[model samples]
Target: MDVDIEDILAELNTDSTAVDQSGNPFSDINNNNNASTLYNESSSYPETNLKTNATSTSIPSPQQDYNNLIILWRNERCAPELLPYPHNLMTRMLSRIQEQMERLEIISMDFLGQQHSTTTTDTTGNNPVNNNNMLPLLCMEAELERIKFVIRSFIRCRLSKIDKFSLYLRQINEENESISPLQDFLSKDEMIYYESHSEILLKLFNDTILKHLPPNMQAINDNTGTVPMIDEPDWNKFVFIKVIGPQNKIFNTDPILIKGDNGKWYYEVIIPELQERVELIIDSIYVMRYKVIKDLLMEGKVTLI
Candidate 1:
């Protein structure tokens, strides 16, 4: 669990490449090429059919979808309560896409109207005909296409993350108070949306996989804690552990018995929530009473935060 700082830095620098410490590709929202690559990778899973309902004949162009996602992501931060529910997010985005398409139609009508008025003026000899009138209209059409493509790429970047890290967010939602600091990202309404979605997925996973388990293993483990269960690997990853009380002049260090090196593995971890770092001690370190950092990042699956 001791992560190599150099390895972490290297991954951060070359995030566009598909190979990380685990050989899986990392998410990069600025990359466009990753859309097709991620789609092809995720397509092998029948459970990952993420497209909107196909009953509606009007399909949104990728650009329009991307634009709506960006707008939604931004709005979620400012007005989390008003953010659309998970089931409705895509529907709302599709509506925005249709609006963009409608603008194209209006633009076409305006062009025709201008052309008709120009023809009348030319017939009266007020002005000579100019082919350049179409230039600005043509330019506007071209610009809209370019905008759509850019928006599509941006959306694909987020979609790729959702496709890959969904397992973490599967059980995360409003009612699950066990996960710490979720309030850092989600609002009350958004939490309800995700909680319901997580329940559905959790039930599906349990139903499909539980039947195959041995009779003794059929019952699920409901207890989740920071303390390791029997035979569970002890976490040695660097963490920000705060002292339970105020720091005084007298200090004593506990003997290092865990995995980290006595001297080399110690780090001054900053706790922004506490606004300070505490003195180091192997045993006195304050791990969360309920949730541990390892479970938050690794197992409990609250990835977005």
Candidate 2:
């Protein structure tokens, strides 16, 4: 029997045929369209998965490979080579470097020692007697003597060297006490006394020797009325003096009046109202020479006697 197209269409339109066993005939058509699209995509892009796997397993680039090769070559070149027992080239190189460093340290230490020796010789006049280095020794001795003369003339006191050094140490100790833990050992009054004495000495030093003594002369004689022989007046006994004028002016060659039989010097004028008697001493003469009297003496305004 021949099938009719109209009947087949009618059967497809029926509810039982249109609906699936689970009541969804359209679901089957949608699934088939999706499968067709997926098949077409897979065919068109055949190497997609292969391309992904290849990218994941890729090796380093040419530049990176070159850099790695260079590093490997360096490692091989620097690698320690095996040597005979008890003799390693790498160890020998390290030992040589260490020896050179030691030698440099020794040279530096010797140079420092020489410098210190030179400085000490310059200051103390005790030249090192390395007969091999005679020129440096002579130079050092000459320089030291020059420095000693300058110090003696400018800074040495009429007091003994020991006394002067003691005073200096005391002054230094007092100054250090401000920052030192040894402050507890010094009494407050002692510190104050040192400071006051130091100030007075500084003023006197500035006014006298520093101001008056000729640059070339180590000793200055300040006796008036006829130059006395060295035996007549003891040079060592002379004390430093400074003569102050009104308004901070100072007098040079300040007249020193020798008292009768006492061999003492006093100021010419005694102000009973102030109960102050000015005195003239070596220091006074020195200061006066620089501050006031030099000009007057040069002008013949005043005579020393």
The lDDT for every candidate, in the order shown, is 0.36, 0.32
Candidate 1, which ten residues in sequence have the lowest lDDT sum?
Answer: 19-28
Residue 232 local lDDT, model 2? 28
Candidate 1 on 84-192: residue-level lDDT in tens?
Answer: 2222334334454465456557656765666677778677533333345445445545654655564465344444333333344443433475753343234354455
lDDT of 2 by residue, 190-258 (tens): 345545765686678768775676664422222232763122211122222233221111233434434
- Residue 34 in candidate 1 has what lDDT? 31
Best by lDDT: 1
Best by TM-score: 1
Q: Could you tell me the TM-score of candidate 1? A: 0.31
Prediction 1 global C-alpha lDDT:
0.36
Which residue ranges in model 1 land beyond 4 Å of their true spot?
A: 1-104, 114-131, 170-204, 215-305
